[model samples]
Target: MPLEFAPANADALPLHVIEQAGLDGWTESQPKSVVTWVRANNFTGSIGQVLLIPGADGAPVAALVGYGKPETRARKRFVLAAAAEKLPEGAWHVASGLPRDVAETEALGWLMTGYAFDRYKSQTPAKAGLVAPEGVDRTRVETLAAAEALIRDLVNTPAQDMGPDALQAAAEALAAEFGASCTAVVGDDLLTHNFPMIHAVGRAAVRAPRLIELRWGEAGPKLTLVGKGVCFDTGGLDIKPASGMLLMKKDMGGAANVLGLARMIMALGLRVQLRVLIPAVENAVAGNAFRPGDILTSRKGLTVEINNTDAEGRLVLADALALADEEAPDMVISMATLTGAARVAVGPDLAPFYTDDEGAAQALAEAAAGAADPVWRMPFHAPYEDLIEPGIADLDNAPGGGMAGSITAALFLRRFVAARYMHFDIFSWQQANAPGRSKGGFGQGPRALLAALPRILNL
Candidate 1:
């Protein structure tokens, strides 16, 4: 369901946020009866704690939400998300005095916490609504929240329903909604069209592999996005153990995030020639499955030795990246759930991005901070270029020793594109639930990218 934003209502319940230091003063300002009730209930201003003030009519008059001590930094953004989830059904608005940006962030968080994947199971929709916070772009916040919901929904879906063809359909639907042109090069045609690596990786699956492309915008700087869309990864000939394959359904998270970001760009009507390329495939095992040690020539004519079939995400992405590079767009962003090493380096909450563009990197870092989408910049580390170099082929899909798995994987993909690029290695699935973030497929850098684009492109 799309996020709901209600018109401002004077009768809406007031949501007052209180820090530990100001709790006493806040209680003192209320009626003596309310203050006695608050003290009786032991309503200390601890983060995520909620206390509802009662009216003489026995209905809720206002809500007191704890912002924790000023020193607690972890619960900064999305501070009111938990309250949004816990508050009684009604129209609400922040009544506390807060900086515009902080109010915007908290308002966005309230909308985000309402998201629940109810595709299969019926769910009671959230009845609570928020009046658009003053000084916040209500439409932009709703658009972003909707885009993120799309990402999470797509990622949380099981492989049976979210296969390669379904992914293509999702892209086509998004394109149609935005008046963008959408097309797909499917099946054995991938070979004829020169996406050999993509074809090889997906040949064994019942669903055909496809290159889904969508183009929008008539003018401005060209921005291209490429995502690895491995719908279900079985590790091909190098099959993963049961535990390893448990969450493989989330392999298409990169594609989901790309589409999410694409939706944001088009919805916001950004002045940029936008192109999205997703190499949709299912890396399954079968008699015809591509094996490790196989050498495949990419669309760019660079040969790759597949040291591990499990490294198939980068292979498909290489071809797509090469296609994105052919036009030499002003900037290219590639996102993929390509390596576990990245998760080890930064954990699931922080996406690790690689780029040589310092200015763009700084802009993304700043944007991430403001958007509550954390991204850590990892060096492209030119020295690791040799690690991806195999004696038999121009590049190795999987390097030996595994010291810098994520770095080497980025280096391998870097060869396919010549334009200024940023690659995000995202662990799309959240292992545990957090405020405003459910334990399912998540969009890592799309929000950060959206925030950074205007500044980076000078829009």
Candidate 2:
């Protein structure tokens, strides 16, 4: 977004910073030397000890912000953003001493603070975008923020309008824009096309569930992206409480994320054969809905016992993953608003991903760090594999144990993937309101994944 308040960078900046500890009385002749020094340098003063400074023209210059000590965790950069909200609308840089990591995060926080979801509201008051101190690509930073914003809008929309058909339509629209091939196996065609699990999970909905496939890039390394597109999960036959159903619309956030990633990939013209698969469905409760205790056959030819209908996300993902696996693509990645356990484990800010490949994992971590959209690596512990066992089926969609709910969910999806796969169990919602991320639906992992792709396919 274009900044309402534009602040330009110059050759040199007059900085004002608060002195901490013993440095307070460096120039002791005057009581307000800190303020005087700040003014002399064309900067501002701090509050730990407030003092005013006169500039070259004998006028008040820039202001100084103080952090008594270093921010322990990187996330505390938001405190600086809160400070930015108060600073006068001008090109202002943090004239204080902070670590390189703190500086980067604070800059990101400033960008985030400039975010306002004014799709339905009036324009917000102008706020200037921050200027990175020495070395930072402002465009790359904004791309990550914009990707998250796009995913949030898609996930926050109601399922009535964001249903399977609409989801497929959205993918088609994106494919059309990028000159990609868009196709779908809709309704009964899912069975005809061997996507039994996907069809079974979505059969109850009146709008009909579908497997939307989009293929882009004709000559490059084949990369497949699959997402759990449960538009609104009602927990199938197992049924969820009223509270659990409240945020079900965001269940399809995985699809939203992948689609958002695709937009970035195509927009940047990344050199990779991008194939996006979204198994769009609404896990609604009805007479025809798939039931717990039922055995469903996945596209990979594995029979899965439905221990809990509430665990339907992985079931649909099973088929989609199986389809992606068939191509044995160079790389395959998937995202899903798959489990509450993930939320309980990591809260909402950091997304947890599981991958068996070390090289991919390292690349993803580096990209996440560079992009400022970090993801934590959760082990796909082999010992926990037994939790997903089924007595009468090849596997159990819902594991018998709840200890490693997120891990088991990833493991279940793993069963269908025969190639290099990275699975994300994302919370996909912001618990509280903050700058760009509203108090509702938010995209968690797309930006990181998008950033990592260039390395993944060696683009």
What TM-score goes with each of the models? 0.98, 0.83
Instruction: Measure candidate 1: CA RMSD.
Output: 1.3
Q: TM-score of model 1 relative to the true fold?
A: 0.98
Instruction: In angstroms, give how far residue 178 of model 1 lies from its true place.
Output: 0.8
Model 1 Cα lDDT, one tens digit per residue, 418-458: 89999999998878767677778988999999999987777
Q: Candidate 2's residue-wise lDDT over 274-384, tens digit each? A: 999999999987889998889998888899998899998998888989889989999889999998899888877888999999988998898787555669999898988
Look at candidate 2 and tell me the lDDT of residue 197. 90
Model 2 error, position 415 (Å): 1.2
Worst 10 residues of 2 by lDDT: 43-52
Error of 2 at 5 (Å): 9.0
Best candidate (score: TM-score): 1
